[model samples]
Target: MAGKRVAGGGGREEDGSKVGLPAMDLALAFPQATPASIFPHSVSDYYQFDDLLTTEERSIRKKVRSIMEKEIAPIMAEYWEKAEFPFNAIPKLASLGVAGGTIKGYGCPGLSITASAITMAEIARVDASCSTFILVHSSLAMVTIALCGSEAQKQNCLPSLSQLCTVGCWALTEPNYGSDASSLRTTATKVPGGWHIDGQKRWIGNSTFADVLVVLARNADTKQLNGFIVRKGAPGLKATKIENKIGLRMVQNGDIVFNKVFVPEEDRLPGVNSFQDISKVLAISRIMVAWQPIGISMGVFDMCHRYLKERKQFGVPLAAFQLNQEKLVRMLGNIQSMLLVGWRLCKLYESGKMTPGHASLGKAWTSRTAREVVSLGRELLGGNGILADFLVAKAFCDLEPIYSYEGTYDINSLVTGREITGVASFKPAALARARL
Candidate 1:
């Protein structure tokens, strides 16, 4: 009985237990608005920020928003429930000509970082999993090849990737090396004509269906980390889908195992000689992660906004109550603050001065804010918030991984802290003691 209260409806306790009342009679009680038109406006209607973009950027934002609302928002819940990627949406998404955004040449859209961040935010406003897929493909995979690959490699891969014919995955996190990726154990040994890879990568997104995978491994002979291009179905390479996840269930993360997987020498990223090169890629990817929490906050705010206006308590609408208004305002303020910082990071990235420390600060701040916003949203929804049917429950569950991935909060904070003070804080206490 405690969990049976219908959303947006008042209930009374009976026989020492809670009992929900019948649905409110809207036809006679409130003649102005109908349930059919209650949600006619998009969630973006609640926020007002027209001066943040130029005409072109605003147009791009509107186009992406329309596509996401019409295509992605409708079926997201079903796909998420089944834990299946919406492969059919690929063509439609590609038709927007935004797959390889932010990069010049190879038929890419060559948009600005602001436009790219807006696209990510709009897509994520509908579903974070879909946004993440795009982020990994464009920011991690294509950008890596563009920045660090040979000219021939770029010419070969960038075209198809721009067209979305080649979905890509980046494999760096191993079964044991998540936050400690610089110390990965995956190894690549040179052979007669190529190289053989042997190791395991866990939590690799899109690997189960990607056309190409960018894998990072240590060279056995030189003992230096390197990046490689590994095509799907390579010999001795296996990717098994990780299932029954509590969050981002539709994204298709995999556990990849490589046993002497053969890759031609040409496939190795020539410019990637050490973990330092890989860090360049991660620095950009972390900025994209900063936008993830923005999306999560948007989702939570939309749900909570709808419920507060409809739900009634003590003969008054919930929105009219001071405490409820305070909670909703606080959530909005937090979102705006997070967005401001994320936008500044994008600007810094565009100016060509963005550092890992800057990206780390944004990622850590926004993710922690998003967690709090979603938790407050769940509290506002009361019992129904825990049910998946309401969507807030899913937002609550999904925020956990976003906070941990792309570098956990503690790691990011230490990164920024060390940069500001010129102190190395990443060493373990025992190691620091030994050094002293």
Candidate 2:
């Protein structure tokens, strides 16, 4: 028998509806090279950076690498395309056992700072967004509590956060103040039982779904920075996800609003009476952030290395061209240098010799260097460079946000400049009051 007439699509006509086309598989569309779904093997460690890590550090690296490639890589591009987090992957991430990085107790792993930093690198190597999610939770939020929270607060929050049973986010930057975070206008007014926090925070990673939020505000009485542990679902607390981001798409960065959100006295962080108090936490966080770019560079280089070998031009492999080989070598050199600088920053922190300048310099330089690495990798991929399925394009976009956050490249450079020059250049000459 003849088939029934179709409306606009296949099969029988029904309501003149169109049938949706099936999604094209990247592999089938581009058969010349494999995408990041089947992640490439790591071949960027040319300088034997592994030897520099301790036994435990190496073990953690291996564990994290395996899970990230096997679990995260397969789903990263999909989620990145959708601009949504893979909520289902939490269990796999928690299994890595590196959360609450550098914290010693309360169900924490108590990893050496080196191990902690290496762990961050390994995570970023596979997906910068996943690494950032963990960084905001562990390095930024959990560390703030560990460094500044009262003993009771620690007892209450750390155990759950360490296991990823509860996620955490730290809120410091406000809508008006990012680089000038110390001048933030969020206010904390003393109330009958505790404090009433009123402010708006922007670009806060994990805030959209964090179980606990560490919010920084100006004390109405003291006029200095103070912090509070604001629970999720608190009255007058709202976190809306920021959308249309070009980078770190898996991370749900949020714009948070607090309208008289009441935090009990016990939830107030006593250590954060002033901005300097949080500066300590920031210095350490900066080191961790520095390692992220290093890891990202590693991933990009690895992706490019595999792509060059698999893809061909004019009947020869891309890797056979002298220019492509030069680009690959340049990327490798950047990664090696970045690795060393990041490692040294950790050591300096461990020895208590690291100053703000040292941390800022490390962060600024490594991120800038990684910028070049990702760019080169992007160039090597040519048309495929713009496709997220191939990994280099995503890394190219991802590196831009990393270059700006945790203090922008210019801000960090000035930080180091001030340390060496003994002159603060953060603000331009003040216009000499216009000489009225």
Candidate 3:
């Protein structure tokens, strides 16, 4: 191919180089020279993660992102500042048709795991509390019923739950049974036609206003774990709101007390007969949490990206600095790996080969990586990172609760360890009684 003459003077090639204008200006075309507004926001799928999602999945992600950016992003800081839940967003959120994303019946949309995971990440990328609210209702509470409830129970409960007319909370954590769920101290005694439960649940999301609570209790007679649907304001069910939380402040974490809360046999989940059964719900939920941090990190990444372009130091964009760019790339790399892990986990779930170990590993690894990315993001933002208005600081704090929930960093590692080595590491602690 021959070079073409420039319109005014020197010949030009297909590369669009102005022949007369020396290539010296190339240095001026640093990253942000492209202009700030053109930069895509809240998006960090660097490794073509979108290519893995189906068209509908992409649509769901886009729709959820749009809603987050448009509605939730504006007032979220105030909600987080006030430590209040956005009660008004329920109908709009419900209308998204993602409540029973993986479940195929009872008004559930039954989207693929990839779609659901993307939705969670998108929502979390803006507001973690909102994402937690949805995940608690969708993946945790709804899945418990969809996967474990009787057909009658499913028919009666899931429709409204999907519609967002009713909110749900999964109650497994207690003041003492945070990690040792297998040894839940909650008791369920069989009555003539119902069961009576007496236990306290700690850090219960959506509990204060949850229309239904999915509580796991040990059978008084069999000693096996069983699931119950405790309705809101049930005579004996008291959901005391927990306050002064440093992280996830908008999540409405509550200390729920089950004082002789009676759940009829019809309200019981027939399939949840053991702690192992709850693990099935957790196996996927853990993966969803892994997806969540990617969004949280992505949100911070977007903030940092925008901050670097807009904020100038030493007469140039902060992002124009080598160290700043390197940090940004590192954050991107961590987020990309996090997304890849979550995507592969979803693929495994779709293929019926997703083990609890897979979910635990992804959750643990991604949460750990995401925490670093967010921390770096706070560093990049300098003073702005500490402000809730910026969201980076909020996510940094919110990560603390998530880093520990589902399974702690160490506990999840232990879970993965057990799967790999075929051995249980959890042994009873030896008492240190003194011989007086």
Candidate 4:
């Protein structure tokens, strides 16, 4: 017996089994608004945040925003889906002149901290993975060289790095020590001409293909922390790509191993004798990390704003619904408050008053707040909220890693708590009480 044709042309056979039809293209099925391919306009600046920026900062922001929209935006979903870095976009990213941020000379831009922080936000506003790539490269690796490297090391390394001609990765976190990175067991032992580094590092962004690795290790003799400039492909040094990441897919994070890798004396960072020296670098990088959520929240809000106005149900735009309007307003409010906190953090750093507590609080609070904003965005998008092409879902996932990195929200809160109350709660007190 022949199959009976279904209502939409799919058929049911005599056995009562249905024959499948080709899946309809999403665009054909939902011919309403477009995906993030043609990025949205900046409507999230509800409080005229531009008024807070200096002329130069505004120019940098504009340049970064334009280039990111034109170049990075179109390719993000594709590369993100593949879980691979878009190596082709390197030149486009480098052209923004935001690399080597706040570092003077050595062919760097030397923009103010505010300008650097703003640039971070702009890049992240489009793609958090791109922002993380640059953060690990410029903010962590290049800044380490600039602040702690010998003059020769800086002269040799910073120029190409600043141009993105060569990429860099900072390796500090280990498989066993992420939040407790200060206790990393990677060791640098004295050798005839240099040091032999041995141990493993994990969750290092850009490590797989990075030309320079700013590796931190313990001094075998003194147990003090030491930093090394390990070149790519050093004998016994191996970086394997980590897979199945739920967020920041475009970043090539890796599990790196040092099997007696040698770092010449010239490559050792003399200024990083103790973990305290690394904190100096972290103090600056954390401020930039704090800006990432600010940018991510902005992007999510803009995406939701456009989506609500464009996508419709019940013969009216989704924006017309009272519930949706409230969510949008809540998202916008979060962005506004996030912008102020991030901006204030920058000002504190500029005045040399920014402490670990200040940077931690900013990163912790903005990221936590942005979580709410992106969640609202995901809700507003409804079914499309789960799709990466829509931007909100991608932003939603990207915000998770940012919330945990630089310092987890809870750890950062404790850091601030310790500062204000003059008591540290990072370690458990139950052990000491039991001993007593």
lDDT of every predicted structure (CA atoms):
0.82, 0.94, 0.85, 0.94
lDDT of 4: 0.94
Tell me the TM-score of model 4.
0.94
The estimated TM-scores of all candidates read 0.88, 0.95, 0.88, 0.94
- For model 1, how does the per-residue alpha-carbon lDDT over 46-91 read when each residue is reduced to its tens digit? 3455477789888888898777767776677778889999999888
User: Where in model 4 is the C-alpha error above 4 Å?
Assistant: 1-26, 432-436
Report the lDDT tens digits of candidate 3 across residue range 188-302.
9999899999988898899999998999999999999999998887898888789899989889889988888888989999999998898889876887898889889888888
Task: List candidate 1 stretches off by more than 4 Å.
Answer: 1-48, 313-315
| Cα RMSD, model 2 | 3.6
Ranking by TM-score: 2, 4, 3, 1
Instruction: Indicate the TM-score of model 1.
Output: 0.88
Of the pair 2 and 3, which is ahead by TM-score?
A: 2
Whichever of 1 and 3 has more lDDT, that candidate is 3
